[model samples]
Target: MRLNTQIQGQGFPIICLHGHPGSSQCMSVFTHHLSQQYLTLAPDLRGYGKSYTRQRFEMKEHLQDLETFFKEFNIDECLILGWSLGGILALELALKFPEKVKGLILIASAARPRGNHPPISIFDYVYTGLAGLINWIFPSWRWNIETLGKRSLFRYLIQQHTKITYHYLAQDAVPAFLQTSGFATDALNQALRLGYNRLENLSQIHCPCLVLAGECDRHITAISSQETSDNLPNSQFYYYSNTAHLFPWEIPQTVLNDIDYWLTQHPEIFQSN
Candidate 1:
């Protein structure tokens, strides 16, 4: 299973993983910024983007596909940068294959599984359902933007419901998200069918970690973010003020700068446990 991947730069390899409703394309700009200091390899995870051709979506298969991706690329060990769901995968990789991970950078990630995630209130559900319907009806990013243009409901969804409020959604996120081809639906179902959540396994991961949190994020509560950092054996947690889930896209330079500072402060070369 050859996942569609994008690679750039030439230093220490940094595997980039996007969040749910995310794709490598959505991550392209972010990785490009990181490419100045590290070799960035961003791939669309299975059941997402270009890899949605599989018959079914399974958490185990996603892990296996990544393990295969590493071997196929001859990546013995490398740093990892993951967002949200991908962050969970990164932590899992570090726990399961300690030698294969140098360091970790997780953004807007939750330690607990989706069940622990905050549920959308009934009022916000209206916006979420509407957004879902729009996504279902118009897979085209341009069409979605034009369709939802300057509408109060769109604003409600962006600012209150999802808090993505991303200008790039029309150009980057929505386009890459559309490429998921409705695979997230199946994947969401698999989450319940498989009953997978590694909240109890945090201590197993020993790699140095950098956890970035958004102060204003509603998707993941501040207390949960703090608890996630507290659980990690080695982690530096930073919360950006006035930021939300789309903080990386909203302020790439600030996010990149913080990441650079964190990486520089850590061991220049990791001697894995």
Candidate 2:
């Protein structure tokens, strides 16, 4: 698959993968900063952005495509940062290509495949359903400049400078979430049907992993990040106190700082592990 990609900066490779409903553009915030120190490449995964392909959406296919894409760039090894669904894919890639993956930074991701059923909460269903309906009706009005500006002064400044439209939320954002959720649900069902717990094989991943969770993330709770950290011998966990599921977007500086510190502490591990 010809994945839509944006390459920037210069130095060691750092591939940024966005989650479902998010395109490479989502990583624009980090690329401008990270690119100064590393060669950052952010790609829109299949079925989400400009990647043109009609194949069935599956995790394996995504992994294979990324492997191929990296190889084509002669990227034998590099750091990887993935958010949400992208984080799950990054984990699978680290397992499948251990030698090629130097370090991993996962944001709001879980090791175990998520359950299909949403928790018993009418509000959850109602809110999500309403969001879906609004998305379908007006797929270009998900983010309102005034609203976001009021929510976070930092985000408002970014918006003012970038002028990123609310269309991202209405059109690409909501539909992307719905699609990935459905796909993950199906993958979970298939794993159960095959009598295999997908996460049972996580022990094979030995790379130095850093799992970051948002304290207020309702989708992937901090408990889930703790569970994932416990399963990996070489993993560390951190939680952003005032962040939500969109921690990376909300606190890019903090995430970058953590990653820089991690690289400093694990220089040898990235080079030789």
Candidate 3:
């Protein structure tokens, strides 16, 4: 599969993978900021954005596509930045092809995800259900008010999964969510249900890793991210206050600076491939 990749800058490559229900566009903020000093390649993985084919993919298939993507671009080695589901893929990529991955920056992601068991509390369920019902009836996306207005119906659905407030949905994130293929979404969910655990294999990936988690993330809890860091042979973990799974957009500069600082700490990330 030839992924539609957004490439920018001209230095050591940093491959950016967006979360589930997202496209490379979701990472554009980071790409634009980081590209000033480092080359950034953000690809629309299969079944998302322009890569949508109505085809379902298993976890291994996604990995194989990434390997093909690397070959096509002659990317022998690079740092990987992944969010949520993309983080799981990044971990698997490092384990499967250790030499090709120099380091990993995980954002709101986990090695061992809960699969079908999301940690939504009873209050969350009630709140989201009522919120969703209200949105469906009144359609907040249609509101004329600027501050409270939403532009996409998908944003409403996303709020049901994450603890993020409705109006806080990042503009860039809405389209990425809307572009996601239903087949792709269903297949990934099925794959997760089958099992997405990687705790046992974290030791195999010896490269430097920086795990960033949202303190208020509902989907991938802070504990899961910390546990992933704990298993990794070499890793650092940090959590942001008042942030959820969408922290990248919520605090773009902070996330960018943290990544830049981490990369600077490990000069090996800039070595020629």
Best model per lDDT: 3
lDDT per residue (tens digit) for residues 1-273 in model 2: 767899999888889898755777777766777898889999878766666454456556777789888877888888888887778878888887888888888878888633222345565455455544554565434353333322432231122212233343444455455444444445434644664233666678777888888776666677777678778768989878866666665566777798778877877554643
Q: What's the TM for model 3?
A: 0.82
Candidate 1 per-residue lDDT over residues 186-211, each given as its tens digit: 77567647755566788887778888
1 versus 2: better TM-score goes to: 1
What are the per-residue Cα lDDT tens digits for candidate 3 across 1-273? 888999999888889998887999878867898899888999998888888685566657778889999999898889999988889889988988888999999988999874232454565555544444444444444342222232223322232333223333444555676688887788787987787788998989989999998776777888899999999999999888776677776676788889888888999876755
Candidate 2 backbone collisions, by pair: 139-170, 139-171
How far does residue 176 in candidate 1 sit from its true spot (Å)? 1.9
TM-score of 1: 0.80
Q: Against the correct fold, how does model 2 do in TM-score?
A: 0.73
lDDT of 3 at 133: 46
Identify the superior model by TM-score, candidate 2 or candidate 3.
3
Clashing pairs in model 1, backbone N/Cα/C closer than 3 A: none
Against the reference, the lDDT scores of all candidates come to: 0.71, 0.67, 0.77
Candidate 1 — which residues are off by over 4 angstroms? 113-165, 192-196, 269-273
**What TM-score do all the candidates reach, one by one?**
0.80, 0.73, 0.82
